[model samples]
Target chain A: MEPRSSGLVVLVLVCPLAAAVLLQLFGRLDRRLCMPTALAACLASLSLTGVLAGNVARGMPWVYHPGNWGGLGIELKMDLLALLFCLLIAGLASLVLVYSYRFIPHELAPRETSYYTVFLFLVSGLLGLSIAGDLLTFWIFMEVMALSAYVLIAIIDVPHAFESSLRYLFMGALSSLAILLGVVLLYGAAGTLNMAGVLGVVRAGANGQATLALALCSVGFCVKGAQVPVHFWLPGAHSAAVTPISAMHSGLVAKLGFYGFARFIFFVFGTTAAVGVLKMTSVLQWIGALSILYGGIMAILEDDLKLMLAYSTISHIGFMLLGISLLSPAGLTGALFHLLDDGLAKACLFLCAGIFIYRDGTRSIQQLKGIALRTPLTAAAFTLAAFSLVGIPPTSGFVAKWYLVLGTLQARRPFFAAVMIIGAMLAAVYAFRVVFYMFFAPERSGALQMDDVPPAMLAPAAILGAGTWVLGIAAIWILPHIQRFVASLVS
Target chain B: MSQALSYFNLTVAFTVFIAGVYMVATEHNLLRKLMGINLCGAGVLLLAILTGFVRRGQQLADGTVAGTNTVVPAMQWLAVAGIVAITAITAVGLALARSHKRVFGTMDLDEKRNGVKQAPPQSTPNATEDRR
Candidate 1:
């Protein structure tokens, strides 16, 4: 029965990937037909993943035995946490693909089919990363997602776009190398790259050298996750990509780092007090706080709107890291909640930015004055998402922040709690800076006249905005579920 | 004395990482900066691999695989694969640099930024604009 379920998991991931290959080959023959076919594949996989996640959340871990002839090879393990993240990945992919149907035509009409085909493959890679229980498989999926992104970003016909893609490729490949080395060290130390196997080895007792290896492994993941002090590539790479790609990168892809952290902390190391694991968590906390402050400060100073949003993502992830670092129930819950909220908010902001670029050919905040009057729906959606970014009341962002604050207080880290407040204030500044520029900034006589977003695009943005509201108001309903999931992870 | 030996390795790796970081920070030459990043990565990889070796000869005696286990295997494969991938990336970067060099006749990091030969005038507006 378990083997059958594992087969189902592999099929769920592979079907879209196969579809991606087919779409790429056949895309040029009938450009108009490509989008629907690719979208259908994503939707199908999204549904299957949904069912798998539901089963897992009901306290059944989905384990896929790779092939009937079993060796000590890699297996896909879907615990509740993996299920939640997979759902986020699938959900974000669906929304972004729907949004791109209309948006891509304005940006790249001739290549719309190719764009989405690559996009679906990228989604498959992300889904694979979240669910992969083996280190080697995780690394393979990580590269697939990243390389596809490099292609997608460079697909735009702008000079800066190409240059930025090259920069992203350089940084991404380097970090991947670091991650590889880390994985190797862990494999060497434990003699098996399986998360369960490693945990067993580490749990035996503390060894000075193994502790150092663990630290190295965490650093590699930290680089991949774009944690502070190693986050130089995020802003430039994110802002320079086409907006839809930007949405997927920030909303879904960056969270892989946090997922890696979560897996290592709970599954690989267990909840035991060892010098190495202790240092990693504390370091993660400090880095999270620093990233929050650094990302916020830089975001406030940015003139380019997309760049500002990109930096803001770094800052928000800082808060997410803060929660995870606490290693408490409330902290884990808050982190998970923020993960969901941040994905929705980022998708909204990126889509809003896409609309701006679509209607009027600019992303300069200064040039976007009076945009609210012209595109009221998009303006409203943007405003809602911005408030969510600031963790304003009645938004899930608020719920996430509230839980985090409480968790920090319970952890007796008042100073860190103060830092969270300051980060929130900075979020207000950066988010409202965009709002003020769009609505209240004095209108120029020749601002580009733009139309309201088409229903295709508007629909997804609306759903995301509603999600923010749901996560904020009904948070208690979902909070305990994530807590139980985290408990399962730690124990 | 063992502490000194470890510190010495740490100092060397730290110096390489710092130098790599500095080149990444200041150098505009894409390939040069990439080399710097590689240097930094190498430093860190050395530190990690060295630590993996340190646990060797510790008297566990239980026949349990220690340093030669899962982490090391994955790291080794990852390292080999990483080098191969980075080399491919460098090749592409070089091709891009050569193309730019052909147009501008120089690939000096600063010159690549400052010097822009005028783009050939577009033959078709919609054709050019549609690509965006």
Candidate 2:
């Protein structure tokens, strides 16, 4: 937790904000330069994250009091887990920016400089969400992120996009409202918004309203994470948006919900047997298991490529939830690992979908049959991502799934082990359905003439595909560390 | 005696919440459904205000430690602000819903199952045609 290391945290969070401001101030100077400028900012952040990751690997978390902000102003803290997620986000965001250079032309006009500005703003908010030390600050960053996302989704201006965006807005507002209520109640009981302070109170067995507040906050976070019944809006919103955005949304935005949940369980609720493990005392496991089954089945049935990917996201998220609900160290680590794996795999899938749309001007799986022959590299990337999705050996997805299964065994939750296996099988069905349909299905006459995706797009997809395996092989590299972090936080 | 007053607010809040949930669950009119969701917010705000009573203070003649303090008063004010903000937002939401319905000819999510089907009114096509 060196002071210098903490400085890197502030830089990571603020780089995007500063870039966003620059974009706003001078984005109009030369409209064509927006993409390159945004990419440069993202790349700079990625490099900063690489340095911070090394720092985190060496020691404890580094908390940078921005302007001595932890004492008075806005505090930025970067622990190992936060660093991992931030790096994942920044890295994938860099790729998305790379893709946007080519993809934006197909969907948006040249004067969409403001769009990139808001996009940068959204990234800044996500960085802030990952690292904020206080609940109030966390809530503020969450709102900024959610607001920017709403605008991004609605910007499609296509008919379904508007309605879906409206639905997403309503849902986002509800979650924010619920979170505010929970935070206020927590503040009322604990008399502080600081995570450490709240953790102290909850650990010391604060009763009555504070307990209720914890329950409400958990509910709010679950909604954000797209738990069942509350997840209806995600499919429409994800499917209807532009492709790179779909990738970013699936990869990063949903992880914020898991981050919030992690912060709450570890920081606010503590690892008390009552609150952490037995909090499920009634039906939490059932809820997680049911979502796993439901999201998987529905994903298999989906006809639209993007929509199926969205449902698969729901199913994959269910695995994370099941891992967390196990309330074991292995389980939490598994959940966290899956967050990384799912982000990369889902990003690859969405980018390929974008490539499909780019090539054929259609997103229907049936219409896309045998179209991958026209773009074998894209098809290969799809197969690798699908293998990752199905948790095949030698991919990051397998590492995540392995940990989750081991967690289920350690927790003595055999049913969840079976559920994870079933979820994986279902993932295989939907993921390969798209791939096989794209590559092997009977050829159709007069399909739109298509070309291989440009290097900018192919490069990101290939990197993510490779990362799926690299992370798998090196899963143990981070496992012990992530386990220690989660256990230490829970302890 | 004052407990009864707080209880009344609590009851009213719960009643509003139930009614709001009912509206949201049952209503079909798109605007009405949005209103129902909004009414649910009112209930939540009311409940938040009432929860302050779980630690209410009595007003004494000297107004010593007995009086409701600044914290509760501030939260009450914040709740009021929340109510106002949500109401204003509901109005904006209603306006957006109305316009969307006008543009699409329906607000039923089920009806728009296949997307906006009217083909975008040819989209001022000629200007873009020249470039292609």
Kindly give the stretch of ten consecutive residues in candidate 1 chain A with the minimal lDDT sum: A65-74
**What digit string (tens of lDDT, one per residue) describes model 1 on residues A1-491?**
13225577887678679889888778767777776877787788778887776667667788886753233347788877777787788788888888888888888776677688879878888878777877767877887787777778766656566566666766676667556655655565576667778778878877543565566667766766677888877887788888888999889777777777777777777657332445667878899999989999998899888998889888888888888888777788888888989999988898888888888889888788877778777888888888888899999999989889887987788888899999999999988988887788776444454456689888788788777887687887777778787776544
TM (B chain), model 2: 0.55
lDDT of 2 by residue, A1-491 (tens): 44354577788878888988998888878767888888888888889888777667776677776555333234577777678888887888889988888888668864367678878988888988888877766877787787678767766556687788777867776677677667666765665567777778777874655666666676777677777878888899899888988999999897676778777777767757234444642245666677788889998888888999898888888888788878777788889999999999999989988988887788888887877667777888888989999999989999899989998998898989999999999998888888888777876544444456789988898888888988898887878788877776545
For model 2, the superposed segments whose C-alpha errors exceed 4 Å read A1-5, A66-74, A273-278, A442-451, B1-69, B72-99, B105-132
TM-score of each: 0.84, 0.85
Question: Which candidate should be chosen as best, given lDDT against the real structure?
Answer: 2
Chain B TM-score of model 1, please?
0.57
Q: Return the top candidate by DockQ.
A: 1
Whole-structure CA lDDT of model 1: 0.74
